[model samples]
Target: MSISLSIHGAAHTVTGSCYLLQSGRTRFLIDCGMFQGSKTLKALNYGDFPFKPEEIDFVLLTHAHIDHSGLIPKLVKHGFAGPIYATHGTIDLLSCMLPDSAHIQEMEVSQLNRRNVRRGRPEVTPIYTVQDAESALRAFSPVTYDEWIEPAEGVRARFWNAGHILGSASIEIELTTGLDSPRLMRLLFSGDIGPEVTSFHPVPESPQGLDYVICESTYGARERPQMTLASRRDLLAAEANDALKDNGVLIIPSFAVERTQELLSDLLALAKERRIPRAPIFLDSPLAIRATEVFMDHADELEDGEAFRHAMRSPLLRTTESAQESRMIERIDGSHIIVAASGMCDAGRIRHHLKNHLWRANATVLMVGYQAEGSLGRILQNGTRAVRIQGDEVKVRARIRTLDIFSGHADGTALTQWIEDRGPVSRGIILVHGEEEGLTALHDRLAKKGLDGDRIFAPELDAVFDLLAESPSKRERPAPRRLQPEVVGQLDWHNDLSRLWLDIEEELEKAADDKARRVVLRRIRRALENERS
Candidate 1:
């Protein structure tokens, strides 16, 4: 009659959001997200799941964002045959997203293996393949928002509009226990709550008064100014106007899903209104193009459906589907905009565009989404003078700008309000999907609002808890973790090695003569020899 919850991913970090819930003989997962960010974190993607995939009864997906649903294909590949329940919109998005994610992995691993061959290292395989992703698709069972369904014995669940993205939802789960008495345990998983004022969808809504609630805190520590859609577009127009004023190219590193669609709609609307000069805005990622089509197909469900459809169909919006066409964009001249994927600039065509344009002083890189710690986008935002891109060092002469107004997640204030609105939580609040600062800030804010500090639980990765207990109690881990919890969100040695290389080059360039450079090299060699000794 007891239930347990395990934090498999997204404990003290913003990506890789998975949770394990077990009640009696029934077992299921809330999400099977892929790990993103630091190498130490991403390494988990290639490792075995903490629990047996075959033992899992089913999965409840929050949305189609890679960080929330990317690893489902891997789960299926690993023998998980259970159905993955998601909203219709989420299913549609994943039909394209999962395959695209697999393709990226295959492509990246192929290139990595080529380099490994050159260096005599063992080749590595991708975590999953396109075929595996398609297989995962076949397992999806779509549910409509606000509808309740039973996926297992003693478990009935409902999906509510999260307002985060197309078909995004906050899941409400009811577990019935004590067969004779029929006691019910209620829980709500707030899957990435969206902001109040957004271009699409109304404010995030959910049922109030629950036994327990697990929430996301991606923007828990940061509060942004409240902006209407018009004001938000005005800001974008200003940035675009300034970036293109000197006939400069504007490169936007965008997420291929909701983020890209939102930007495309606004950009086209601005152009149509003559707020910003009309220029060919190239959608460079094939994944993004496909997602845009999904958005168009589901426009009737959105807030400004007609406007969005109009914006999406604009002639100024050009989609480059072929690799040749993508490469050809580099040969173009003048003040056009390039919207490419891998929003954090960690992968995808955005890196290629960055390598080609980052050295140009007139080019501008506009970041319109969250950039995790140690991501290339964050590094650029930190004002690094140079960065290595695809084995080539590129000077960062281009203007780097961030517009936080476009974030899908609610800000600190909005998140706090959302949590408050889901009030009268009888058991406790479990915070996940955030870094240390965010988790702490949200915890403190909740405390200030008169909630008991002890009731707010911020569990680390792989930490298990007894959900039926009077208070959240941690359980001993069954096995050692792939990486220490301390190493999850912070920069790892891989990042350090990159920085070390950059530093050495900087020092060598600063040397007055060859003799001085030789002296520096000799000192480094001596240090290495000492370490070996």
Candidate 2:
């Protein structure tokens, strides 16, 4: 029997990157991420898991980003009693991230409950808890890069640095069945590549001898501008200098994991140089500070050969106690620059700051990360004159600026450039993690670059693709399939309708747990061919 891979999540859109893989009687999950951005995507976070959590043999994590690892505690809560695997850095980060995420979910749910009191709507409980987070972490087994481990029967796993963040990796898999005609399944899951080769870390080397490729195309439609390390520093300094005119607050909405550390390191260097005025710069967001400490613990991943040396010279300001955070907020009333988490201005202390400063026009709101659709950061980035927070619509007077060069995600041109360097790994490539616009844009470009739609496909979330044994003597290259926008428009009414064409090969009994899953997977695969054509 042939092994299979499913587009469990991050198929069409960038968030909630879960992929289900199977070989023989074994099953496992990869990157149990959460859905973010617009309501449409958020709806996915509340839906069923599709497969029985207890039945999954194990879980493998790519990194600790909320989108890639936020749902682990929830999975554990839902009966996934198996062990989880990740890198040492990922484990440390997740140790902090899981509890933080659980706290947020609980707080958000509580807030919703309060609102429900008036509306009389049903209350929604949080997906997990602090205890759940702690419970999930107990199963984590940290492995370093390039180490081979068996995740499931016939499946061999290895990790390679993706350079996206500290401990982020691209997963490599090899599987061999115990049969006379044993087949080798070699697959690479490009777990969200980083933007550049930084002084803090090395770039991801292209893998060799890959048979199938599952790549991410988050910024799949745009060209990434070349930016030097010094240029990024200069850009932020200029922004700070401009904001320091009145000695007002400089609010940078950072991702709290990688970007926050990078900013903290940069600011520490500037403070030493006395480049900008040294008003008390506060590092709020308990999660960000804790996550930064995790970075320090795993400082081996930090770049530039002297991160340890630099730490010795100028240590970080990572606060822990509640009073420390309060102190940071209180100092903001004076001439101070405050760096907080939730980079997209979605929630946390950053939102409180925005509530206070949105109408002041004295403060500066600087964004240094990607702002997904429907996020407060995007609303401000779009030049919205006014915005709402919590309940009040605050007038926009604060200076709004976004510096994209500091973003961790690789843009469209970079992703294509990386794919171009592939040395015959596999002709068939599937692009994941992007909006429909981004995916469609990338699909057309890849086609022009000689990877026609038949050779390279961008799948929709929950979409499925079938692999058949390749002919040894006569292999035909697949032709580009024309986009059926009209058909796609019709699909607005009903989804995955192509299952009507199922034949005897539509074996649902052979799939996980039920005949329905078999039918659903089969139809989802058929829908892909029609949706593209």
Collision count for each candidate, in order: 0, 2
State model 2's lDDT.
Answer: 0.74
Q: Which candidate achieves the best lDDT against the true structure?
A: 1
* RMSD of candidate 2 to true structure, Å: 13.1
On residues 146-238, what C-alpha lDDT tens digit does candidate 2 reach at each position? 989986668889998888888899898887854588777677888988887454667775577667778888778867667887787777788
What is the overall TM-score of model 2 with all chains considered together? 0.84
Q: Cα lDDT of all candidates, in order? A: 0.91, 0.74
The TM-score that candidate 1 achieves is 0.98
Weakest 10 consecutive residues of candidate 2 by summed lDDT: 489-498
- Where does model 2 exceed 4 Å of error? 177-180, 305-324, 327-334, 469-533
